[model samples]
Target: MNKGVVKMDFSEEKILETALKVVKSNIAGAKVCKPVLASFAGRKGQKALTIEIRLDSVKLKYRVEIKAAVTKSDKMLLAMTNKETGLPVMLMTQYVNPEMAEELKQIGLEFIDSAGNMFINQPPVFVFIKGNKLKEPVRCAIKRAFKKAGLKLIFALLTTPGLENTTYREIAVAAGVSLGSIDYIMAELKEMGYLRRRVDNSLYLEQKDDLVRRWVMAYPEQLRPKLTLGTFRGPEKWWLHGRLPSQDTMWSGEVAAHKMTDYLHPETVTIYCRPQKLNGLLLSNRLSRDPVGNIEILEKFWNNDEKSASGELVHPLLVYADLIASGDPRNAEAAEKIYEQHILQLVR
Candidate 1:
């Protein structure tokens, strides 16, 4: 072990207790310190360690950093901490072999070579359960199994190219749920409108009914028109006809849509948002001049587009923003009606 490096089995409680002792020993007269353990991580292939600590007292609250050498076996301790403290723990490294680097890059893991090139890791898509209604053990077990098996399954199904329709059996197997219990949970989700059975007898988990699906599935189609327009000069010509949004935007939208769908539970209702408009000059000159105003303008633009539509528009971007701005989108029916009317126009 390197100097200043501590070798220990990873246990959240043990690490936390050791951290508190270190704090107390280091900070003389720190009687009033309240140490809240945040998270921890063990770097792969290296003994590097990092721990987040929040210290609170009457004077002020401050963060404490503890760094050390760590190994793979330490990850279990960190994961245990994450389970108990509800903080995220990430296992990462900057020194990966070229082949491993390529593989990690493909899976979207944050990585860097010895040469200092950096890559950000992609987070796993999470299926959230709402209302504190789910059994914690079951959810945790499912999440764990999903994290462990999800990438393998993704590769097995070759689902990288399109939306993969997964079954309860798949989810059950991936999530470590019992076959018998799958039906009960599926039934609950069905009743809550978070999932539906397809004609193929497979289960489709919806973020919220048909709205998220339409937006996600239709986004590329909607962009086809703007993408076909190619490069243009002004706002007037800025639309994605056939081209896709930048990778960042598409990924962000996917994540946002998934989150909204999980939370909103919209059945028979759909949420919609127009594709973000990107014109080089407009974005660089006018929008960049004032970011706050730029966002405001974008909001106004989205609102105006929705308002001008002859039918309903249910994009959560439009509805959620308006809900925050004016408290109207809170009414499920009203929001759904708006979405339906606009969607109807698009289809017609």
Candidate 2:
């Protein structure tokens, strides 16, 4: 393969075209056919393209999903989509690195990429290719609704019922963001098909699970870093007796998971509090700032009243995000419990 940039539009048609070129060139007696748009009932925003692959005389059809980027969270959803449709679902993306490629193959899901990296396990067409690199990565415009302040606003809408239908000022207050950002964020949500206008002209939020997944993936990168107050070292079992003024502080990460699910023993503690209260919290808990500390405090981004009924703990969504972001297997397991018991209804 030539290491040259291929400037192309990032559309379903273009993605399929680029990937199939590699498929035909690499596999013997492979034939490409036009793809058809595939839509499923009860799944509004999940769309795929049905592509046909001919190996000699045998033809295999796949529900080809097109994605700009794929992550671990996508694995379960892709598997469920395959089961629901009873057709082999193949993922077509810009690239699938070695780690994700192995995980996807382990789950028996097929995938292909424009870089010529692929895995196909259907009988009579066992093709596995890896280590091919793209000359340059494709870039796309990111929507505002997934960025920092926009994420806060979207979080408010996702967790609060009828918040999207409320005034922009109220949405801003709840999200602790500027009122001016609301209109553009709402517009971007509508453009992305996550929000729709009803016949009465009120906004309706749809495809919430997908939205939640995107929010979780972007938070650690886009918003969480900007909110960090500091990391500190505290006495062992400090959280066991520590007091948080419920009005100004809340728990997250491992501590929040243990408090909410009573599952894993917390190895670290996470707190979210107003900026002005950081010193008060540390002084009260006898914590000292440390670069590599067991305790982390982030500036609280959402409003005080937005706290869920759990009181001292942030919403289950934030806890789940914290665990997933931690990249620990135990935390990931605990996050599953939080998702099932507390956060499932919010998205569905």
Candidate 3:
């Protein structure tokens, strides 16, 4: 079919007239509904037009929305009419943000430039995990495998035209993961009945019936806060904070440990610090360099300093003490002695 070029004189009525002409000219036995002007801007420095066209016939009923932005040149307006309807196009350097490109994709618009060098139909997958109180180690393993394999999986699915049948090796190479890992993950998923492999080795991920239920049950209720210790402007400064699901619940040391594990495990680091006690006083004393004297110092402020009878403090000095206690069995004994002589003396 010869593509029709419809031009309007930059008015609402003219725009609708042009769209109707295009529909009548190109589609056989199709009727054009009244065009809705989605957006129209013609003022100083910006000029654009966007319209939605609806077509209905015995065989097909579909809607096409078109947006054309113009500057000094009319190239973008012309390009909008000529470009293929639903294929992704690589945008030029002039495009402002990645989101404009994504918006085009969401609307099923393909936007290639003159050179045909770009495509942007990157499919996204939603992962659903099941079970409650799963181990941290297990979650880490699953996330790592997914990151390594996700891009390849999406690419393979996009390039492969039909769903007739394919092999595991084909999917593995396309997903860029070791065959062994792919096989292992697939086996685990299948045993859980979250996936199925056909006789032809085609693998499919099944959407679970109770996916949201599993998510609600598996979500963690508490998380640990983090402590940042650094030298700001040549003076030692320490700050501690953590985000909780809500403010009503006080932070817990065990929850903090789990949060630390979640954040640091990918980097292969460990948290060696303990929760701080008598944090505010310790900050003052560490600055003063005065002997805390004995357990009395801590005992005096224990009720005032504690978040509650049950809440734990994640202090910098406590972390340092924990590290010292960890390195040498004798240092643990020394820490107790130091606490009794200095920190406890102040509180008492």
User: Which runs in model 3 stand beyond 4 Å of their true positions?
Assistant: 1-145, 154-164, 197-203, 208-348
User: What's the residue-level lDDT of 330 in candidate 3?
Assistant: 29
Give the distance in Å from residue 183's predicted Cα in candidate 2 to where it truly belongs. Answer: 1.4
What TM-score quantifies how close candidate 2 is to the native fold?
0.80
lDDT tens digits, residue span 1-348, model 2: 111111123464567778888788988889889876555442333444578899987888887766667755456556545655546888888889988898888878899998999999888779888888877556655567878989999888987889888888888999999989999998877766688877899877776766786788778767988998999999999998898865779999999889887898999899999989988898888999999998999988987255557688888888888887775656666877887787777876
State which candidate has the highest TM-score. 2
Which 10-residue window in model 3 sums to the lowest lDDT? 216-225
Q: Please write out the lDDT profile of model 1 over residues 119-196, one tens digit for every residue.
A: 332233211111221111111122111222332232122211112355656645543335465556545445534445
Q: What is the Cα-based TM-score of model 3?
A: 0.18
Instruction: List runs of model 1 lying over 4 Å from the truth.
Output: 1-10, 32-58, 62-146, 150-239, 244-348
Question: Candidate 3's C-alpha lDDT?
Answer: 0.29
Candidate 1 vs candidate 3, TM-score winner: 1
At residue 175, what lDDT does model 1 achieve?
A: 34
> lDDT per model, in order?
0.30, 0.78, 0.29
lDDT of the structure predicted as candidate 2 = 0.78
Query: In terms of lDDT, which candidate is stronger, 2 or 3?
Result: 2
